[model samples]
Target: MAALTTDSAKTDPLIRITDLTFIYPGSVKPVLRQLNLDFHQGERVGIMAPNGSGKTTLFYLLMGLLKPDSGTIEIFGKPVRSEKEFENIRKRIGMLFQDSDDQLFSPTVLEDVAFGPLNLGKKPAEAKLIARDTLNQLGLEGFENRVTHKLSGGEKRLVSLATVLAMEPEVLLLDEPSNGLDEETKTRLITHLSDLDLSYMIISHDHDFLYELAQSNYTMKNGQLEPMERMHIHYHSHPHTSHRH
Candidate 1:
């Protein structure tokens, strides 16, 4: 297993949000209020929030998909405020949406996975190679020619993740990544995620999944984020049995 990175080095944050506030159009209540966060390199951050608690809204604001009513968002030490500014940032921050259908639209699995690299200006062959490698990384070998819409819900979710990973982003924002997955698929997802070196913020309600991978965890409530106490988990492995407590 890869060693989890700690914030002991005192380096600048990879991404920062300060005094951020946002309210949806025509809505009086702000979904997010004075939100602040700092994400460091190689960190796995977990966010737990109930439905409609503004977790997804926070992600959109970070991606510049939704404009903040007030405050600032900085990525890679640069302030991002406009769509033009976010274009390059988007290349560095890959997001996996809550719904697989929202992310995958290509006819074949390979095309869907390769789309990001292709759009990033890689040649078709190079993009295809990246797509294949990403799929294999997620234990999806030989799924290249599979019909995108015909895949099972779990398969589609993994393929969606492959699409994001193909971009080789510096940061990842995963929303509800384990929503429709069974226990076996979820464990597979955790294993794959644990192997990656990239920094990511995962929004999940599954405590077990978050506990498995997140180095730091937070709870979102009333438009604010509060750090959660880290739970000490002990892992035990035996023949045909694996569990954590």
Candidate 2:
């Protein structure tokens, strides 16, 4: 397994949020309120929240897909506000949506996996090579020519992951990656995810899966992102913050 990077340990935060707030238009109440969090290089942070708790909204804000009504977000110590700025930052950050169908469109699995690389300006041959290697990494060696629509639910998920991995992203934002997998497939997915050499923020309701990957955990409650455990231990900075019930 590759060693996770620690460049941000003695340097600065890779992602920072302060006093963030947002609400969907026409909604009576805000989905997030005064949220503050920091992510360092090569760390895995797991987030848990009930339905409609704004986990997806948080990811959208971080990616600048949705503009926050208040507060600021910073990536690599710089503020990202516009689509161009976020697009530049996105080169380093890859996102995997909850639904596999949302990501997979090509007829063949290999083509879908190579899509990101091709868009990044890699040569067709080079993109295919990257796609092939990513699939092999996920233990899907012979799936290159497989028809994506004919794949099983677990296979689709793995192929979706392969597409993201092919981009060689520095930061990964995964939302409910294990949603519909059986036990065996979930186990395999966990094993592969645990071996990646990068930072990630995973939002999932799978408590056991999250525990296996996260050094620490947080959850959204009443629009507040708080520590899941009573001790409120944070892995990034020392001096654990205060806990709230």
Candidate 3:
């Protein structure tokens, strides 16, 4: 597989949202309204906002699970006009929801992690190798045979990440990754996420995590994203701005 090179990558924005708006079925007010944003390759961005601020809805829209009422979305410089385009881009993007349980539905961790690559038509043995490698990368060496529901909350999250990691996506989106995690697990997760080189977009209210892991930060308020001066500031400068939140 080819890494997204800078020259070739620059020719196409990894994500482009222009005047995007979305309204759920039978809803009067638009959940997302006239949003404009752009994401380039190799950037780690943090999206911050309170609950009911359309954070999850934006994630769903980006994943192409929901279509906008009237607006434009481009993934990898290709126009997202139909389901075909979405299908093409979906393979390149991996998304993890707020709840790992939502993603870890397979009976066993190994089976769960292998599901994505298997669905992509890889042979079972090949998928198994990918799953095992991903599990090891996340420091889960022998829990592959364990039942997902039996694992601890943190372990389940790691399994969830392994599932997406097997797909080798160019872009990774994480929503509330630290939710329900213990201190040790949260630290481990932060360390693992820090080492990833792919383009990443993370939504969290955890200021410390964002300050440390994100190259840029955007706050979603009133259906728009505003960049604060602190986006370029070093992590130590803020001293955990989100601790009270």
lDDT of 2 by residue, 1-245 (tens): 13323643556789989889998999979899888988888789989889999999999999989999998999998999999999988888989999999889999999999999999999999999999999999999999999999999999999999999899999999999989899899989899999999899999887667867887788998787887772343323434365321
Candidate 3 TM-score to native: 0.89
Give the C-alpha miss distance for residue 67 in model 1, angstroms: 0.5
Per-residue CA lDDT of model 1 for 195-243, tens digit only, reads 9889999999887889888889988877889888775222223344455
Ranking by lDDT: 1, 2, 3
> Residue 168 CA error for candidate 3 (Å)?
0.3
Off by over 4 Å in 1: 1-10, 232-244
TM-score of each: 0.91, 0.89, 0.89
Identify the superior model by TM-score, candidate 1 or candidate 2.
1
Could you say which candidate leads in TM-score? 1
Off by over 4 Å in 2: 1-9, 230-245
- True lDDT of residue 35, candidate 1: 88
lDDT of each candidate versus the true structure: 0.89, 0.89, 0.85
Rank the models by TM-score, top first: 1, 3, 2
lDDT of prediction 1: 0.89
lDDT measured at residue 117 in model 2 versus the true structure, 0 to 100: 92
